[model samples]
Target: MIKQTFTSLAFLCFALITFNVNAQDFKDLDKSPMDAASFPTSNRVTEKVVKVIYSRPQLKGRMVESLTPHGKVWRTGANEATSITFYKDVTFGSTPVKAGTYSLFTIPGEKEWTFIINSDVDVWGAYSYNKNNDVARATGTVTEGNKSLEVFSIAFDKDGAMHLGWGTVRVSVPIK
Candidate 1:
């Protein structure tokens, strides 16, 4: 009787462990809804610049009211602020922007978008956003997107330039 009980208990423990392992494996196979959702986005790479844009679903609404609300610090998207990498120094809105990787953030308003260049890099999101580390800030105009964007995304223009706009506002950052 004792032998049988011990063997049964060991078998039960092994089965439980196997079940737990399989459960974890199954969980890994499941994709998050956010990850599965498709967003309109694109990317462009050139000898001088790499540009990306995040167009949210709300872009179909009014530019000033729908896409970017007044007096809000937008992370640019779910990830780190919209990012751009330049191969050489370039001038942005009369300010000289140096070549390097930088996080692009914006303060959206009715009239314009205040584009920010920060020192932080490779961050998971804007959770670590620090305004004090800002390298430069430039004001740019907002324009309507040619098509509707379902998801927030970034893309580069034909000229190796960066354009970020959703709703009613689009800002262009040139690559040197």
Candidate 2:
């Protein structure tokens, strides 16, 4: 029991130190900080077969296209590269991907956004992103969100289209 208590106290001290160091890095930001999110796109069976994990970045009055850029490659989500996992082999946007996890990236465009599923699952932002590691690519058109979103969101439609929305823009890519 004493050992467990000591370990817990050590963990708490580490957490506090890490929080203090990271908080100083973002002190200039007035609001709309970056955050993480996760969800499953399918409810098909007892076990969940599809999942997405990503960081949500707030728009903070910035244009989505301006923030993400029109042609530059993006990590799709903030902080770490957005990742999606498939519990079973499934076709995504005309490409067959085996059951595994992959980093989700994109190139935002005015009319359409090019989506990418890459073999690199662990990465930060898009600093280390490489096109050679891309496993699949698909193009999806952009649409208006139902309402302006202050925080970026990634959700799956009932039909299995993964919807990515921020500001007034929304993009849907089919995952089957």
Highest-scoring model, lDDT = 2
Sequence-dependent TM-score of model 1: 0.62
lDDT of 1 by residue, 69-172 (tens): 66776767654455656556776556788888787777776667777788787665566879898888877676676765544544555554456645434666
**What is the C-alpha lDDT profile of model 2 across 45-118, one tens digit per residue?**
45655788887787777788787999999988788888888878877899988989999899999999999999
Question: What value does the lDDT take at residue 66 in candidate 2?
Answer: 80
- Scanning candidate 2 in windows of ten residues, the lowest lDDT window is 35-44
* Position 167, candidate 1: lDDT: 43
Instruction: Give the Å error, residue 138, model 2.
Output: 0.8
What is the clash count for each candidate, in the order shown? 11, 0
| lDDT for predicted candidate 1 compared with the true structure | 0.59
Once model 1 is optimally superposed onto the true structure by TM-score, how far is the C-alpha of residue 170 displaced, in angstroms? 3.8
